[model samples]
Target chain A: MSVLDEVLSANEAYAASFDKGGLALPPARGFAILTCMDARLDPAKYAGLSEGDAHVIRNAGGRASDDAIRSLVISYKLLGTSEWFVIHHTDCGMEFFTDEVITGLLANSLETAALGDDGFYDVGTGPGSDHGQHIDWLTISDQTQAVVDDVVRIKEHPLVPPRIPVHGFLYDVRTGRLIEVPVPSDESAA
Target chain B: MSVLDEVLSANEAYAASFDKGGLALPPARGFAILTCMDARLDPAKYAGLSEGDAHVIRNAGGRASDDAIRSLVISYKLLGTSEWFVIHHTDCGMEFFTDEVITGLLANSLETAALGDDGFYDVGTGPGSDHGQHIDWLTISDQTQAVVDDVVRIKEHPLVPPRIPVHGFLYDVRTGRLIEVPVPSDESAA
Candidate 1:
């Protein structure tokens, strides 16, 4: 079965575990998670969550910026979210890349978009051939300070309530388990 | 109340609602998503997902290259998932960036850790920034195409299964309503 198929199959089994739940289904007795779009990793296997329980959001390195925070504001204020889970893993591509390069490239490319080299840019098949090589700056190989910083960013974020719990976890690509990192509580002076 | 306070308060109510379900344990839920690191967009409110339901993930237009995909696969497969939601808003920032400038800038700055400035480098934030961007080529602005392509990619992915049922959505920042995009039964056709 393909990755989607396995998830579906697992979802069926997972859903079967709790068809009609207590009260109103706990809203997110199931959840929607936002993580990176990396192909080699599997979420349900790592986060200890299963199908029929959560929603998964995959983007790059699962970074929570103004935009994602905006969505979080909505997901909680309007959607009824209770907990916050942010996972930044080891050997992440996010570690190696940089913003200036990306945005700058766009600015340059757009400036020259209408013209090839100088006009009619090639939007199709970008940069290199591998399509697999991640920018070095984008990759976060270690799971320490980065995870803490992200968690702190989430917890202290003015957008989120100081008390709204935000967690930081590490999903070891090789092992497929999300290890929760020790983060200072939102109330911590440090 | 701050965004977190607002969410926590609502979570208290949401959690109270859960008490009747017998799970009765929490004052809050999980995960708040910050995307793009782009301030102009909203993912959940626009995607139609209920508030307090799930965390949001934002980066460069929600592209799931091998790196991001690997993390998601694990988050879903192991952590547990039932819904896989994509909240790509109109006029995304991913539409503005590229791989060239990203690689070039990084290699020049960290010139030592060169991944070759001329290839398919994924640009993003500097070390510890956790701000991730995307490769210009793989990301698409067309909602229909992006959604269909993502769903198909997730569904047909060799690593995932067919039954996973990936869903696509467009969030209109103006409307604040999650517009569900239709995925062709076989969106992979294109």
Candidate 2:
């Protein structure tokens, strides 16, 4: 079966036993989490969230991209969340390629690139766009530093309230541990 | 205890018994899902995803914003995900406000707004910014149409491979069900 069909079938089983029919519009736990879209890091499992616990905003590197900031703004501004967490993970695919490399690959072809021992290489067919060059891609170099940077970015965004404590952490994909990434004293104090 | 402390405590237990430590960097299921950050929807449980099953990109409304497309591009390009799903849920907070309403709230104060019977009303303190004015917010009008629009946006993006089938669905918040939103015949054919 297609993944869509498989998941929908799973949903049927989930809904058959579904008792969480009255969860409020706002998060019950009064916090939000920003994490990577990595398949391995299940925020609900790692963070022990039941439905209606916290807002989860995820993207490529979980970096505080403008869009992520927008989500965070809405989460706190309209939804009553007070605290926030920026969680990136180890072994992230984002660590494998630079913006230039991915853009170049997209410029060559829209086909999937092969990840060799060295790194990703384009198969090179046709029908690509220059629009890839316009995006930041938000690739990561150092996982620990990326976490700190995202926390700082979210904490410092003008729309984000200074009272909301934004914590940074790195999830270990191998061991399922969340290691706290210390924000610099200066940034943390701010 | 703070919510952070509560979750960290939970993470310790999860890590202690962790055994799935050898999963690869790419998704084992070869699919990606884009959905809302609503606390009521646990994508893992609803979709039957284990750790390393599929890429899950989430935001405020699960709309196909530029950043979402960037993540989708990277998901298929570098990570080998073959299919994608766009899911927006019922009773979404995104349906509670508009760009003008949110921006006006932020302009008044960065404080959280109250959702009354009429709609969201600002608490209004001070120390706000006009930055919210610059954001698209990507709020929802009709939940069903939003899912269709996101799926179409992702499918039509020039960087997206034409062969990847982008499916649309609306998750029922009350029932924990995944209801397929019919993509228009023309878009489905494309």
Candidate 3:
């Protein structure tokens, strides 16, 4: 059976015993969290959020990119979220590649790269071949700086209100501890 | 104290007891989940996932936009994730407004729209004013179709390998139940 079948089966049991069905559409806590897609780092458990608490947006590196900002705008504007959290975790796969080098990595088969760059060969059939859909992986060598930059991006974006407080954190995936990354003072900090 | 300060304080206690710090970079299960930003629906719990299991990519409505595709590309090519799961939920705020109407709603203040659009007044200072940063919220009038279309998009994307199996689910946020949305027998399901 496929892994999805397993999840669906699990959902059957979850639904059987489910009780919290009437939570409001908007998050109860009036905030949104942008965090990595790492499975070990369960954002809800570590963040002290219960059902209906806050919006949790996860991506590969949790780097508040354009799409993330788009979501943040909706979270705050349409969904009533006021605060935003950007959380990047330690020992992330993001540290494995530099943003520039990842373009080559995105082209070649994982099988080719898994052994190391020695065997790297582009399929040329993938999205990398299409110049229009190309995207930077945004991998990071210095995660602290990345988190700080993403927080600043959200803070400075005109779409984000000045009243909204954006905070950045580096999460230790192994220990489940979060260390706050201080944002640099700028016009947006005002 | 701010909710973030509270979270940081809680993290101190969590870090004191931290143990699992050795999990590898690639997801142990070799899959990724695309879902909404709802707080009430914890992806790990509902999806029967534990730490270090699967990558979870989330955005406003879990729509498979260019940014989402970018993350999925990275998840599969660089991180060894093969399967993709798109899970949208019921009672979603996405159902509250259309994509075009949301641009107008994205302006000025949240309290103004939280009450209703009748009170909505554009601030003329936000991203709504910037024609370039404007993003279609990808709002959905029919979510089930949205999930199926998103799944098809992933399956057809050049970056996503043909062998990768993509599945769609409509999660009932109220009941914590996930109903599988089967891919239509057409272009990408081969």
Candidate 4:
């Protein structure tokens, strides 16, 4: 069966046993979390959030990029979220490659797919041409630094309320332990 | 207790019983899901995804913007994920406001916070100033159309392999039903 089919079947079971239906519009905990899209970091399970607790905004590296800021603005301005948690995990896939390497792979894939030869379907090859120009992969060389940078970005954002505390964290994929990264306290912040 | 404290306490409890420890780097299901950051949409329960099943990339409206594309490229090129599921939900918060409305609220909040008066904190107000310039907000007037547009964006991305299937779906928040949205088939895609 296809993966979609499996999920659909699972959804059927979930619907049948669904009980948590009346959650409020805004997050119950008055916070939003920005984290990596790693399957291992189950926000609800690891973060101890039940249904309707918090808004979990996830991307590849969990970098507080422009997209993350946009979401945070909505989370605070409209959805009543006050706190921001920027969590980047240890041993992230993003740490493994640079922007150029990834874009090169993509370019190669496109070129090979155009050729339409099944034999040429090799995911791994020698260094590919640099197609990742100007794309900040946001690849994590240092996990703690990445998280701290994101926290600062949130704290400094004009749209993000100065009252909202932005916390940075690092989750170890192997041990499943969450370590709090210390960010410089913004004295000027409300 | 603060929400973070509550969650940290929960995380401790979760770690005590955590058993899904050693899942691999890549998703086992070879797929990734793009969806909203709504608390109600528990991907594991509703989509039948377990730990290490799929990379769930979430944001405000689940729009396939540049950041989403960056993540998708990583998921496909670095990770083994092959399929893409763009799932937008019913009763999304995005449908409630435009970019201007949200940005205006933010501006008002910043102004109020600057005033340093707790009594001035009012969430209910009409017609906020335009604080959301250059921010797409990815606001959804129509949920289905938004999903379709995101799916198309993913399909048309240069980095995304044309061979990979991009499916769009609408998830009902109240009833927990997953409805598939029809996307035009790309006959040229592998």
How well does candidate 4 match the true structure in TM-score terms?
A: 0.88
The alpha-carbon lDDT assigned to residue A35 of candidate 4 equals 92
Model 3 chain B, TM?
0.87
Ranking by lDDT: 2, 3, 4, 1
Worst 10 contiguous positions by lDDT, candidate 1 chain B: B22-31
For candidate 2, give the docking quality class from DockQ: high
Say which candidate scores most in TM-score.
Answer: 2
List A-chain TM-scores for all predictions: 0.59, 0.96, 0.86, 0.85
Q: What lDDT tens digits, residue by residue, belong to model 4 across residues A20-62?
A: 7677667878888999998777888888777677898899999
Output the lDDT of residue B118, model 1.
71
TM-score per candidate:
0.40, 0.97, 0.89, 0.88
Model 3, B156: alpha-carbon shift in Å? 1.2
Model 2 chain B lowest lDDT segment of ten: B114-123
Candidate 4 on B76-129: residue-level lDDT in tens? 776778888888888788887776665656555443221114523354443334
- What global local distance difference test value does model 4 have? 0.76
RMSD from true fold, candidate 2: 1.4
- Candidate 2: the clashing residue pairs are none
Best by DockQ: 2
